[model samples]
Target chain A: MISSIGILTSWLLFLLLALVFITNNLLKINIYVRLIVFLNVCLFLLLEIGLFFDDFTVSYISNYSASTTPPLYKFASLWGALDGSILLWNLTLSLFMYFYLKNFKINTSNVDIKIYSSILFFFVGYTIFSSSPFAGCIEANEIGCNLSTLLPFQDLVSSQIGRGPNPLLQNHPLMAIHPPFLYIGYVGMSAPFVASVSRLVLKETSSEWVNVAQKLTFIPWLFLTIGISLGAVWSYEVLGWGGYWAWDPVENVSFIPWLLSTAFLHSAKVTKHNNSLLNWNYVLVGLMFLSTLFGTFITRSGVLISVHAFSNGTIGTYLLIGMLIFSLLFLYIGSINRRYFISSEKLKNKFGRSGFFIANNILLFSSAIVVFIGTIYPLFYETIFSRQITIGRNYFDVLVGPILLLLIFLMIFSIKLSIKNINLKKLYEDNIIFINSSLLISIIFLMLFNRSFNLVVTISISFILISLITLNIIKNFNKKGNSSYWAGQIAHLGLGVLAIGIILNFTQSFSQEIEINSFDNFIFSENNYQIYDIVQENLPEKTELKLPISNGKITKFTSLNIFNNSSQQAISSPAIFRNLIKDSYISIKSINNNTFKLIVRENFGISIIWIGLFITSTSFLPKLKLRK
Target chain B: MKSKKFSLILIIILIFLSFYKISNESRFEKWSKILLCPVCQGEVIYDSPSEYASDMKDILQEQIKTGYTDEQIYNFWVTRYGERIVTDNIARNFEIILIPIAIISIFIIIFLRKINAKK
Candidate 1:
């Protein structure tokens, strides 16, 4: 009877599946899919509302929620734990599945919709059977099951009172926005997977699916980009470090699918324009879905050690088996229908714009493969030689750095290159002015600063790219360009600015850890910083360090707040002085009365990276208008 | 023909410079990046904020000042801790290095073959 909630959830999914089958095989009405989707959404919302209300009879509510928690965190607790996260994933999938079904009903067959329905049902079923949030409690005591039973009860009396979400999850508001956006992006992959599978089932090789796949891929891709960026911002702010990206396995797993989908989006266009690379596009789409599942498996399996990994459980094995089955099914379908997907058409100019796109795909896909292998290599090594080894930032930097530079190089050339012809004369005439200006600017930049050759080259490349994109955008707008064209140009411009910001940050950011007592003075990066005051507050039960930093002309006062919690370790909030060119940040490592160790860092050009992200995400808004 | 030759020469120079720049980074920088932070999960010594990571950085800097080779410094860490103390050298990670190269090579071959196919 305790499992009744999961059982009831599964039964609802089953009924929805039955209705979909009936709609496909017998009724032929589109409204049934809509009805099922609406019902599923309502069920999920009701369960979450029950959680918000602290309905401790439900096992999940008792596990992640408490009566004393704030309303907002109580709502976020739905995704703070593993089981509820899966339910949220299922809900997001149904939402997207509903829209996808509505959009494609007129264009695609009922069988295609049924296949989509089946995919949604399988996920919902997986959640109910393997990792359901709706399991019920036996006793339903007032304080709920002592979920803190697993932890060493330092204060057993307080532990029995109440509990809250995971400390890291509750620390920041971004947790609410970040995980759901990521899940929505991950679950949105079902659309393209359904489209790709439906095409294979229908035995059609035309470019129809390419169009649908391309359009649908962008929706998830945009959400994924925002999710990744927000995740980076969260880490930068909350992880107590100034660095945003650490190239961790969890980060790499999420990134790999974005890379694959980017390749697929580019190649889908090639498949349409050149009538080539059809098989490549299909393979990329399949890989995108596979990467999502693989990422989910890694996060849930707990085979790897990561700060971002979810709680370990048997659900991982279920996800792994599901991944293997889907991968094998794709392989079988690919091998059997390989020839139909292949095309005999060739590129008009083998080394033209289309060629650049192909090169882009190669670079992206190869880097994705590198990241995937790097992520799994530790597991493989552990299984084989019984050794644990981690591939860190250096491995990724060594491989991906050059590939990214090459991508930028290709992007610069390809944008100006002709699509179907090798017009050397025209190309030269068009680019000679831009090339000369770029060189002049590079020379001036080198003269202005004493820097390494690599830094100079990178800056010059980014400058040239920015200038080129600006010129192109101006020309296009003068011609009364369409929104799609502007979107591409704006997005590319954002990448140019972002690359410059990243390069500058990597080369120039510096940090120093210093032990300080009260009234200690330290000079760093041409600034003198003095610990002016230390205040301890009682009501908030926090310590605040006041440090005044001065560079003769500009003086800034920054405070680092330290909060002590009885149940968990003390948490420190770093103080940051944000500037357009640089961010001066200080974090406290440990504090005792007047003496503490402080980490001071000067982060250069990070603001530009944030600005670039904003511009790039905004570029997609034009696409919505274009769709109309 | 002259412009083509000039562009080709420019590209070769660019390639050589980039290759040289990557290989010739300062020894202190390379050594600090090579070690793993003892207390942090999967973070390199240079990026982690742990006291152990700070101590490792001090050891690396001292060794570099004493004119120790990168290998000798790496051996110092490995001798004290296990081989897990340092970031896995891709140079020594045969399986890890081989699989990625093979995968990329195969994909490139397939990609080239597709592009070169006749209508």
Candidate 2:
């Protein structure tokens, strides 16, 4: 009964809010917004109450939460399944809308709010109609109740116990936070999208919206960078693959928005200066928003088979239709306001700072396109030819790799060109010494180490980028520079560091699967290790097999957890020994009588990737502060 | 002029140095990475921990021992499981490469044309 009431109340409230905003163009009523936000909060609290109380009467609670689950995991279970995640997504969107309305400037009209509220209403209605967590199930079964349409229920069987959260999700704590970060990043893109759409709808020609959009873009971009990196870290630590990025369809979708938003940031920066990329900024913002929707659709609809996709539902079609509606809306707005997109000034120099910014935008956008195509091509091929094909990491490595390298090279010179009155030739003249020294150092290092082709190229470019950044810091350390300038340099440095880490880890990492007898020693990466003991523990929910392997000085315990669930799934937790230089990862594949197979991997310079990601994402902090 | 010549020389040296191979990766390691595990959702045989993947690896090893070349092995998998099993069949889908190149080139050309019109 409470679930039904919650669903009806939220549904009616969203409908009423959308109607109010649509009817009253000048509606600045804070009370209405406050009431909606408060009620949304209450709804979330109600769900949490149900989860904590283990209310099997509520289908979502019974399906995803159990009494034996930990408190943190109980909290995280709200987003573990399809219905609850949509609710979470709606909550995040509402919060973003509240902040956006609160921070709206005076000159900005209420149309933006109307469009934004309508978006919220659409999502809320979609949730209510399609995948409402509050919807009651018809009959209880061993697994759970079958999802029924939105209707009032007499009463569910309260005697039924709840199934716990997915074992894979509960195994790692990172699962608790990763989705929220990605959702925040995904939902925040709507702000810039709304601002741009409203700008076009109002036919406002001033560049003031650029400032708003740029500020809006950065927060989401920062969160997205962190979100994607945290995801990489989670996969590396938990997936037992000894690899971070797999270029999966779902991963590519998330990255596409990040890439597009990055392009928007640069182009919007240029638009603020000279308005050359005004139309381009609008298109980029639209694409960024569209890509997020596409990502959500891909993840939820199960159109493409990805490890991260949720169960198949009708919600995918709704989202696809939503995408269609928004695309048409964007196109109509763009066509009517096409004249307003023309720039007042022309780009004079191809090698100037603005020019490089444009080039950067192109590269980023092109890479986004490449990833989008690579992700969707398989589906298209399957539909057309009735055959499945896999467009995997190698496709992306071949296509997007050079673009990233070019972006890094552009970073090396763009900073130098930012100085006043410095042409390309003049910038080159100033940095020639640093460049030559960097090249020499890379060549000598390559000779000493004797690395692969990919490593040689990455090391050379990374050295050049490092030299450029160091020189720029030495030259500008005492001088005052804008927050964006320093942020750009730090982000560039982070990119360089991340690139080097990725390449080195890829080329230098070694993995081997060996079957060894009990207490037998094995040599891996020139280190001798032997299994000292094996311990097995049985818990209420799972059985764990722990193996303590020692390298004469220290012992590390790696365990395989076998869950006593319907799936009987087993998850291996790798024991990773980390230092400043490399990480030694060991995991047990399987064990038989008197013997066990171990997958041991050595990843070099992997720590630098995390350091680089930290630096890169935090580089936006000063700029965000400036926004305040 | 001096910087341009110096950069040209550097590029030449770097290109020559890239061909110097040092890392030793076995043929099995190379082929396992591009072959998708039949049971796992997007995981290559090189990374998947499923029993099916392990069995596939054994079969792959047997093929190698039977003197099958890289192309022959890939062809065998493709024939058995269709094109989906081979993750990186660039030879078959050449248009995937061309489409991106064409899109990027179009963007560059349009950009340059716009700049030239302004000039």
Weakest 10 consecutive residues of candidate 2 chain A by summed lDDT: A414-423
lDDT of 2 at A287: 87
lDDT per residue for candidate 1 within A1-628, as digits (tens), equals 2235444655677677767866644344456666666666766676667766666656667757666666777788888878778778877877777788667543546766776776667677665556566655544444444332211112222223234566566656887789888887888887887787677767776777778888788888878888988888888776667888888888988999889988887788777776787777778888899889999888778877776887557778888887887788677777777677655366667677677788899999999988998888888878988866768776787788778777776667645655765575776567666765664565555443335555667766877788887888777654655565566667777877777777767766777777887777888777777775565554333344555544445655444544333244444456667787688877776666777777888887778888877777777866666655
lDDT minimum window of 10 residues, candidate 1 chain A: A150-159
Interface RMSD values, listed in order for every candidate: 5.1, 3.9
Top DockQ prediction, candidate number: 2
List model 2 lDDT by residue over A1-628, tens digit each: 6677767777767766766485654444465666667777777787888889877767788778878777888899988888888778878887887888778533556788777877788788876777777766567766556554476555555426677788778778998999888889999999888887887788887877778888788878888988999999989888887888999988999999999988887877777776676667778889899899999898889888877887657889999999999989889998887677665357655556778787898899889989998999888889999999898788899889888988987888756665133476776777787777788788886775547787888889888898899677678845766777777888888999898788778777778998988788999888889886679998765688998888777888888888654374578888888865578999888878768888898887789888888779878755665544
C-alpha RMSD values across all candidates: 4.8, 2.6
Q: Any runs in candidate 2 off by more than 4 Å, and if so which?
A: A23-28, A105-108, A419-422, A447-450, A474-478, A624-628, B1-16, B111-119
What value does the TM-score of chain B take for model 1?
A: 0.66
Among all windows of ten consecutive residues in candidate 1 chain B, which has the lowest summed lDDT? B16-25
